[model samples]
Target: MQQSNTYIIVFTAILTIILGGLLSLANQGLKPMQDKSIEIDTKKQILGAVVDVSEMSNQQILDYYNGTIKSIVVDYNGELIETDEKGSPIVAEEVNIPKNFKQQPEDRQYPVFIYHAEGNDDAVEAYILPMYGTGLWGPIWGYVALETDLNTIKGAVFDHETETPGLGARITEKEVQQRFENKQIYDENGNLESVYMLKGESNPESALDEHHINGMSGATITGKGLSDMLKSYFSYYQGYIEKVKSEKSVASL
Candidate 1:
């Protein structure tokens, strides 16, 4: 027996509705897990800049992040921004870096994360700056932790969306990042010279001088991108940095 046109239309509509509802419910169920994973990964990246997080579990990362790290948002002039224009409180971790990167520099929100060693909440071990830039194939970003002097690199950790695996992707390697440790970002005149990378392989002793590191053997473009990102962010945070330095100088008087 042949079905009537109206019956076929009605059955198709019912199937479509049921399928759509199931899809929506599935998405709702998965959202929380996705958000949680993102949060844990972000915490790991931030913490990795100041300390070793490779051996940490997910819960450990969360606990250490909540317990030892403090963060604040600042504006272009490096003045603290307590709240958004609508009066809601601003959070450093919640600041969207790529979104802010699209906005004008003076209009963007900068997040500064301060790290405190375990058992000492009153002392700041390092100041971590978030950095973003363009790589050979995609976006690259990282966190750089500066020592209490705010001029010496305490540590660094970088990531990229898509770059040549063996060449530019090496930026995410621990050894490559360690190359930046203790490298000074200031010149003798107290100027913020920042740091750069040479074109090819070199030893740590030869790399750390006034302000340069050894670039990956075949990744000069990505290397330049890294240097540019650091210098640009450092200049952006110069206001806050100078303020801190001034206060410290006064305290020593």
Candidate 2:
């Protein structure tokens, strides 16, 4: 009886060790695939902000991003910075948005992605900006695509970590996002009045109409958070936008 009990304990120990080793090995083998999946998902989100990528395959998304997107890093003074030895701007994808957001606005390295539509020689189709904010449940983030004029919104795509399914999560819905289309971020006086999600329905003909969009009914807090996020990020990009406008004005003269 004593010998049998000892053997049972030894067997249990060996089994536990074997199982632990196998689990570790599995995790190690899957790490590369997991990282690849995350990379693909991020690329898809970025592209979706500028164009319709819902039907696009992984390869197609990657191809489109690599072919047409030009990434530029700019400073608070609106000056282009962080170039390589060849004097080319660093790739925007390499800029860590979350980390940069944590830094002071002027100290942050902002990533701007310029998209060129097919056959449009040297002209920018849209500029994509990254935004992050807290939601009811957790972190909510997205990308906003601006037209060349820098004041008009061309498109937007949002995603959240743990927002309520039917409420705050609706921000990711097509209809909700479509409301931002053609929205103006700046007022006629050239003031930065960032676009906002109103608590109730917006009056299209109202003076503040260009800056307002209808908010989700049951998600007022989430809507406010989204509005604040857009305002803060747009303010950060103001310097670069102003620089671009000035350059264009000079070129036209």
Candidate 3:
């Protein structure tokens, strides 16, 4: 009996080792494909803000993103951050927005994606800004693309990790996102009030509408959360936006 027990233990140990090694090798082999998939998905989300990417293939999205968009990383003070402490150049797409949002709002770095017109280096069509915050159930994030004026929202795309189905999750739909089109972020007094979604329903037809969007019918909290995110991120990006506006003004003059 003792001899049999020893044999069982040895067999189990060897089997465990073999399985672990197999898993490690599998992971190593799959990582590159996984990373490329993630890259394509991220590009789709980013470009979906300004263009219709649903009909686009992965390679097309990659080509469009590479050809049409340029990105930059800016500090809380709105100054461009070109390199890290180790001297590796910082990349906007590589910035971990959710992790950065964990810090104080004033301490977070912002990523801006500039969308340029085809074949024209001098004409910028829009500036895309990424936003991150909590939703009713989990984390929510998206991109908002502003027109060259830097105040009007040209388009937006939002997604949540685990929001309720048919309610808060509706934020991921194009209908909800399109509501943000042409909305102004700054008020007449030059205050960055951000955009709000009223509870109950959308009031886009109201004459008084400027900074307000129609709220999700049954997802008031999610709507508010989205509004808060916009407000917070817009404030964080305000300095950079102001700098661009100043430069454009000078260029026009």
Candidate 4:
């Protein structure tokens, strides 16, 4: 009886080891594919902020991104710090927004993507800024595309890690996102009052207001999260916006 028990224990231990080894091997083999899937998804999200990418093929997305988008890394002072040998801005897609979010805004490397519309002689149509923040459940992140004026939103695309379905998750809905279109980030006095997601229905008269949007029902926390996220990111990019405005003013003179 003692020998039989020993054998049973040995068999169970061997089976466990074998299963663990197999699982480890599977994970190692899948890591590259997983990384690639994440990369493609991120590109899709970035492109979606500017154009309709819902029906775009993966190759098409890559082609459009490579051809029309120029990425740059900037400092808090709105100075371009990283550039290629030819004096072109390097692609800043690898700037890692989530990691940078934890650092002081001055210390963070901001990634900005300039989208040039086709047949427009390479004129920048919009600037895309990446944003990250906390939601009720987990991390919420997205991209906001600003018009060339740098003060109005062209479009926005948001995604959450673990928001509750039908509630906080509604922030990802198209209708909710479309509400951001044409929203102004600055006030009449030229103050940088970034757009906010209100707690409930905003005043209809204020619908044309530049700084507020009606909040989602039953998702007050999430709405606040979105508002906070937009404000924080817009502030980070404020330096660049100011620099562009200054340059435009000088050019016009």
TM-score list, all predictions: 0.88, 0.86, 0.88, 0.89
Can you give the lDDT of residue 136 in candidate 1? 90
Pick by TM-score: 1 or 4, better one? 4
What candidate 3 gets wrong by more than 4 Å, as runs, is: 1-26, 202-208
Quickly count the clashes in candidate 3: 1
lDDT of 3 by residue, 194-226 (tens): 888888674547733768878888998999899
Candidate closer to the true structure by lDDT (higher is better), 2 or 3: 3
Clashing pairs in 4: none
Please provide, for model 4 over 103-205, each residue's C-alpha lDDT reduced to its tens digit, 9 standing for 90 to 100: 9999888888888875452599999999999999899999999998898899999999999999999988888999899999998888889998877755476
The regions of model 2 sitting more than 4 angstroms off are 1-23, 83-89, 119-121, 200-208
Stretches > 4 Å off in candidate 1:
1-27, 203-208
**lDDT (CA) per prediction:** 0.92, 0.87, 0.90, 0.88
Instruction: Please write out the lDDT profile of model 2 over residues 124-169, one tens digit for every residue.
Output: 8999998888878888899999999999999999999888898999
> Which ranges of candidate 4 are over 4 A from the true structure?
1-15, 83-91, 119-121, 201-208
Clashing pairs in 2: none
* Global local distance difference test of model 1: 0.92
